[model samples]
Target chain A: MNGKYRILLPVLSLTVLLAAVFYLQPRAMSYFGLNLLFNLAVPIALATIAQMMIIMVNDIDLSVGTFVSFVACVTATFLNDAPLIGVAILLASILAYAAIGALIHIRQLPAIVVTLGMSFVWGGLAVLLLPSPGGAAPAWIRTVMTVKPPLVPMAVVACILIAGLTHLLIMRSSTGTLLRAVGGNAQAVARSGWSVTKLKAGAYALAGVFGVLAGVCLVGLTTSADANIALRYTLLSIAGVILGGGEFTGGRVSPVGAVLGALTLALAGSFLSFMRLSPDWQIGAQGAILILVLAVRLIFSRRGRKWKGAENG
Target chain B: MNTKAKLLGAAALVAVTLPGHAVADTADKRIALSNNYAGNSWRQAMLESWAKVGDKAVEDGVVAAADAFTTSENQATEQAAQIQNMILQGYDAIVVNAASPTALNGAIKEACDAGITVVSFDGIVTEPCAWRIAVDFKEMGRQQVEYLAGRLPDGGNLLEIRGLAGVFVDDEIHAGIEEGVAEFPKFKIVGSVHGDWAQDVAQKAVAGVLPSLPEISGVVTQGGDGYGAAQAIKAAGRDMPIIVMGNRQDEMKWWAEARDENGYETLSLSIAPGVGTLALWVAQQVLDGAEVPKDLTVPFLKVTQDTLDETLAATPEGSVANVEYSQEDAKSVIAAAK
Candidate 1:
């Protein structure tokens, strides 16, 4: 019946199971396995948190996925022919994505609506940039992301640090409180003399920054940029947000929880692929798992709330 | 009695398809051709050929109609559903490049039970009912390795990049290599692994494996993704003269030409898909009662940077078939080898 118990139990269960499985399957410790986990886990988690950031502000950024896709495609093309241009491409892309969020804010439209339309625009733009997935990621960047550089996948560590910072900010700031208040009751937040629209726009822009980081990580792991990849990652990222104690109506999404959910999905995907399931069934099974997980979550939430109500009475 | 009756009926109709002209034609027969959607140029070409021949037959007053549905993407389930749909629509004949060889077995069998003449192309059928018209994948693979061994007389190191693991094609290709290398004991197979048919995946696999075997002298690959292998070689800090071999993807052809013109040591024994195209043509003739070889291979090209000029000079500039093998009405399988 504990509200906290509902959230903490799954985390505990997953941790224990993963520990046992990792011990049982030491191949999970192999270089390939580690690279695979490091590849999907970081980006998927970053995208999930980015999405949840917007949701926490009572808005959604459907464009995060496609925006990342475009960034990935652009980064690949720019980096391929000119390896030295990596940093500039990344910074410019991040700023552009953030600017897009600012535009959505200034326009005063729903974040969901604007981002949904922008998703297609970004994907189309990705096609315009890279007609196909080709070329190699810069050796220096690839070494940092895929190889065991001075600190392997410094990007993964950066994301976790960002998550901690986001947590700290939510706990310590008035802006974070305003975001929550808007999510729970927009009109009430408006009465408090805060611009709900501006806060929401800022939340979306922050989310875009997270998506940009994820795109950078992908650029490192993959040699080429593909326009079609994010088409699947979009919904899967949303699923990660929901699984992280975030309501679609929007409230209290834990960044840590988002990362954990992403890791779990990544591991599951690695398991499916390593086990050698046919590719056709792999996608179907992933989709079905998403549906089933969400359905189970809904059932657990309903039951937990009912038990709490009974206990209080 | 009914089973015997059906077999007798099928056997009696040696001249199938359409009636008339010098070639056989029912001129009124109907055929249902189903293909997995043309997601890429390679697949699109397959479907175009299917439609071109079918349309010609229809226009020539041979077949009453050629009913066809191209599945979206490479989805096997969609293709199975497509075949079942074609069966329900009751076309006289069906041709399939099944999405999954095994996944489509039961459904393909069901199509056969429905009295549809079935021919499978590219990929084989899971069920054992249809007439299997296929390119000699094993021969193609073996042939490439033989060419590679000849070029790399010393054969210090050769890396083999495999296609979708466990597919019939992969096995055939691998087996062909094994068969080809059985004699050349000096030419060591440096390393081999699967690339899963994606350029990025191939690149990563190559990247991972390349560091371990930096002394690799040559590379072999499946269709289209040889660029990844070549990229991996450069990434590994080795400019080892590599003999890269693969087929398909319009880009690979241009890559081959450029590699040739640049005088790179790469040899694109790109199996001009010329052989498979001819296999289908012979199958179509057999379906139409025209006598033809039971098994045949049209031709394959092993063009290199050295031969690029010669190959190009043979064809008219700016033509589709430029810098390639001469396409001809092949009657039987030939050496197609140097």
Candidate 2:
């Protein structure tokens, strides 16, 4: 419910996670351990924070997966020292994403419908841009991804910088507070003298910015970006948001939680692969973990409601 | 929407035109070889060779052309759609590198039934109706293991990193390896792993099994992904003298001639590029109404440092090995056959 209690959740969780990591040791350190976990955290952290930004305005932007994947592929293929063209493309793609958000808000379409349609369009355009996966990312740009400087992964640094910047922006501006208010009660916020549509679009623009960052992370981790990469993360990012307690209805899903979820999944994969357990079981187990975590939350919420009601009476 | 539909609709119209053209004159027609997608270098070489051969066809009007339909990869459904479009566009014959060979049966049959010939290369379709062009992958595996066993004649352990599982390539290679190893008593396979033909995953798969595979005399893998196995072996500082990969003639030439700057001796041989080429020829021949036998096995070269030949250096890029035919030679062969 509060800081210490929230800290306990991850702290206790990491202990169990670390214990399992040691248990699975053939070399006493698995590929999915701290370093890899931190790497996994980078993309999920950026994306979840981005998603949370949109959610804070009670709007959803489903095209972020497409955004990141498209940006990564384009960056790999087109983000060159042409200097002028690269800047234009980056600005264009961001504006395109923001424009999609604005249109949906203006039309008053359900975020689910508009964003879902936007995903198909964004993904279609990505495929059209780079039909195959031959292109290479710029050497200097990709250099940030492949190495760990000063014992910290480039991904970890990227993640921390993104998180810190996001924190600073939202904390410094009234826009962040307005967005949260809109999420809690859109009608009330609009009545209280704010342009709800603009606020909602700003939230989505933040998601777009985060999507661009995720694309950068992708280029670093996987030196190549293809059409297939974007398709997989569509659902994975959503899962990250929900798993990190980022409400679909617009609430804070801690960036840390999203990173942890990604790390846990990657570690689970590494563990199963190490054991020579067939990948089938690995997939089934991951799905089961998701369902189990959600079910536990569902049960706890019911109990929480009952306890609160009893105390109030 | 109307403009887009009209353009696509017109393209579709032309694709269906091949069948009618074929009916009027099968003896000499502009034959188009329409294919789904060129996703990899293997398929790239396959298609490029087909196009070159088509260009070199003897009869002036009886030309061969290759029309690449889509750039998308691994989308079987899109691939099937392309096939249907080819049929409608009236390509007199098709050389299919099916995404899922089995899933392609219905469409392949539709084209064949309409008198537009269809033959599959690279990926063998489930349909028995279409001829499979390529090497006996089974024999290639056998040959691979046999070569390794001969090198380590006293019989030693092997770490086998396989390709994408469940596909035709893996299945045939696995079967061939098993068959070949059965004959060699000294050969004991230590570990078999799947890397899904992904370089990084294969590298890790090799790393994971390396420590336990101390007795390993050789490492064998699906050729394209073999670099991954080789990288892992090098990183581990294990000098397992035998390593094999997919045979691109150009690369094989490099391997045979490669002077090591990093100080590891280069032991290289040409695997078989001929398999995919042979498959292409078989498809060509069958579509041309030539009676091919039940199946054919494209040959493999087992070169060591001892057998390194400068003859390989003379072999031209994009030219098929042992295809000695010139324009006149092709005409003579066709005339004699006729």
Candidate 3:
């Protein structure tokens, strides 16, 4: 399959979705309207990227949502009240993620089970940190998140920067190639004098960094954190990665695609609510759209592979 | 047949509570407050109120010890386990804000069989053996909508900011709003969104729909979303409509300021966080051999421009709108319930 085509497909679909929403509510095309619609997309995109990093190493992070939520709880409580302890805790949590990666590599355990177990642990810890949701986010963080730039929505600018930076790190760097190779063919990468476990651990650490950022951004927007605030992100992040041309195996992912996918889903909710559809059907509608996008991606990728095969033949 | 069973059930509960009644004069009685979910300010306020009242009771020799347990997961099974542990610890009474209406019935019945008094509030349980203390959230919703209906006499577009979807309180309140709207021919609900009972979420939701909605004359919101709705309206640079304020301190402040500045007249109502204190008093009463009723209905606190200043002054910083009730007031509520 053509590399450019893979990127174009999801981007094109996102454009179409955005256009439809803009057409339905013309006022949504404005900067303020878009800001309102995409205000919550930054954290979701970060979480999706975090999940994408795990997928890049052929491991799924079931705990990303809870981990992000835990970070949010920390951000609202200790981060606001006691900066030194909060920073230490945040750094420690990242280290813990790295350790989880090492543990999975050492034990040869399924990543799903380990992360699922960790989700409970992270959730419990978050509850302990902030039993109820009343804490405030740091003033600077809130200001950064709520800032409205001159032309485009602040969320769009943030997404562009996130995708650009992640793209450079994961798609353009040497370590990125090795990380993908670790998932693609670990034995071959190992035989080539690279430590597969180290690369995998690096991917998990990167995932942790993104998860922390996601939590911080979420707290900035929410101004308060509850243990279950981002519980839905577990599935949403997975869906965003898949919708953004990420695969379950072989460590295939696109940072730009993932951000666009997050934006698409966030806008879908706003679009539906703007249309005043019944809340009961809104969730079903979101599912239908997600399935439709995935199905289209499946068909396109399959056809692209067939065309490539024909050319090779 | 159902009526007869209910009567027998009531008699059985009375018989069960009678033992505690007999032992009311005991020097010390341990009480545990078990909450299913402690993820919101309301729950926090309830717990704080319990601590305040419970500590006073402890000092007064009304309770030997007062302990609070909460499940962060909001899981019914977790709450049930907590209740079981409370019973095992030989608590004289267990006050619960149930996670589920029916999930704790069996555990409550177990506590009941073990001669423990169970009092469930807010998200109450269905176990006939347990006493329920709560406000009519549905009626509150109805009244909010009715007030908006009165404002929009000719029937205008109303943006409805609902509470968390699939929640029992949300469902009841939504149903009541629907019923209230049915009574008012002029009221039209043009747009509805789930605020999840949070200010930020509510503001975002209202902002999203405001672009597509034709001029909304009023916004009917469940408590916690009222101030957010107003903020969304203000942010949109649209004319402020009749927004019913919630019980939040921020809402009271906004209401007072808006009224003083522009004479903005809107009704605000909320199930006070002090209800937990009422439950505490009721627990003390029950343990004191007062024969408290099996069920008690607390009224929602209403705030108008006239009452906004007082409400704001009464509520502490960062707290929700509330009404303080004394032990005598709780006794009156108990008597009224009977």
Candidate 4:
């Protein structure tokens, strides 16, 4: 319930996971090992931040996964071969996301239904862009992603920057307060003379921007792209936001928490694979860890409420 | 509910085919293809191959019409629905690349009862009445492993990039790899990860486990991820091991370039997308009342260093290399089927 514990929970969890990974594979402590372990985290963390932005507005984008894939498709194919056309398409797609936000607001439609429909559209467009799963990522993006900083891995640095910048923008700024107010009490915020539509649209546009970054980083890491490349991101991002002390429709989220949540999940997978477990058990084990974390959070929240009740008594 | 629809659909099929039966019996057969999914280049290549061969068959008067329908949904129910529609269209034969091994059995059986010749290939069904055409994937895996073992005869660390987890093909190929690896006592598997037979996924997985693994001497993978695995190794700045390639165009291109520059010798082999054409061939033979076996096993095609250039030349820029069988080749395969 305390402000410090709010941040400490996810941070501590990430630390424990990293410690375990290092323990299991001691080599993971090295720069190269850490690089390998966390190389894919940049995109995942970016996706988590993107989803966090949507959740802050009490809306979910079911299409973020496919949208990221679509961006990657464009990045690998058109961006590599024909820059102007690819950049144009990417900008158009982002603007479309903003328009979608406006459409949802003006029409008073359910975000889930709209986003679910858009998922297919995005997936289809990605398939159309790159029918096959072969294309080279632009060289500059690859170099930036693969850069080895002195102490920490580039992935860790990217995660820190994403978390820090988003935290400052969304958690420390007045505009972010307005965005959260739109989710927490839209009518109240509207009565106070701000355009709720603009705030919500802003959130979606930011989500789209982060989604594009996620896609670019992913293609950079993988050196190729496919329509189904980041398809799992939708669910993973939702899970990351929730795991990082976020609430649905409550407008309560933390950027640091979201990034750490993504890192935790990503590390959990690497840990399992590093242990050489069978593929069947690995998926099940991931589910089990998620359930365990959620259960612990539930127990802690209930205990916090009970402690408050005792004080009131 | 399904039975009633099947009856009505069968009735409609009979009503539609009654007039055409007289002409089709003497002239040419009408064939329809029901594909389960079209998300990947492999499926696209298969469909294209089907179209090419089907058009040729039509021109050659082997059949009156050849039609292909693909479902975007990977679910078997969706594919079954497509097959039902095809049955109502009164096609004389249905060739299928099934989604699940058993999910489409009911729909396929209904087509069979309607006197439609059903042939399933690649992701084949277990229904006993239909003809199943497929290359031995287990042999494909074994042969790939054997080839790798020969390259590293002194025994070395191998990293295995597996296909999709829980898939029948993934399990079959993996089992064969295990069997082959068992024979070569010196070869050691250092690490194994499921790539889901996808490039991006395989690259991420291989990158993740690379640091913890022993120095990998060779990499083994299913198709669709060979180039990805190679990229991961190259990025790690490790020596490029002898990677057993899946017959992807990118892999072939990479191998050809590598051979040209460094004299690196590596072979590429896979389950060709031309299996679709083979399925068409079997359907044609059966439509012509040839004695085609209920189950026929086609051998996997192997492309060595000598043949990589030609295969790459034939493959389109961003597709897998496919081995299309000629009409004569199909007839011989049918004649030799046990």
Top-scoring candidate (lDDT): 4
lDDT of 4 by residue, B249-323 (tens): 888898888888899888788878888888887887788667789998875767798888888899998888888
What TM-score would every model get versus the actual structure?
Answer: 0.48, 0.48, 0.52, 0.52
iRMSD, per candidate, in listed order: 15.2, 17.3, 17.4, 18.5
lDDT of 2 by residue, A259-312 (tens): 545445444444443343433354577677667656655565566678778989
Worst lDDT 10-window in candidate 4 chain B: B19-28
lDDT of 1 by residue, B1-338 (tens): 99999897786575453243324454555676666655555554545555565666577765677654654336443355456545544466776666544445545665677666676756655356675555676776677667677877886677888889757678877787777777666566788878775667787898888777747766666655676766666677877446455543432455655565675555565444233344344444445665543234435455656665565455333221222111134333322311
Residue A139 Cα positional deviation in candidate 3, in Å, after optimal superposition: 1.1
As a TM-score, model 3 comes out at 0.52
CA deviation > 4 Å runs, candidate 2 = A1-15, A26-33, A167-173, A250-252, A299-313, B1-338
Q: Chain B, model 4, TM-score against the native?
A: 0.84
Q: Kindly provide the TM-score of model 1 when superposed on the true structure, using C-alpha atoms.
A: 0.48
Per-residue C-alpha lDDT of model 3 across residues A1-313, encoded as one tens digit per residue: 4467568767877888888777776766777556645657788899999999899888899999899989988998889999899899999998888888888987899999999999999999988987645576888887898787888879889999999999998889998888888878888998999877777788888899999999988777656666776776888899888888888888778888888888887766655544545434656888888988878877887899998899899
* Per-model C-alpha RMSD: 20.2, 24.2, 24.3, 24.5
DockQ of each: 0.02, 0.02, 0.01, 0.01
Poorest stretch of ten by lDDT in candidate 3 chain A: A271-280
Candidate lDDT values, in order: 0.61, 0.59, 0.80, 0.81
Model 3 C-alpha lDDT per residue in residues B243-337, reported as the tens digit of each score: 88787888878888888899889998988877877776677677777878898998788987677787789888878876655578778898888
Q: Residue B223 CA error for candidate 3 (Å)?
A: 21
Between which residue pairs do clashes occur in model 4?
Answer: none
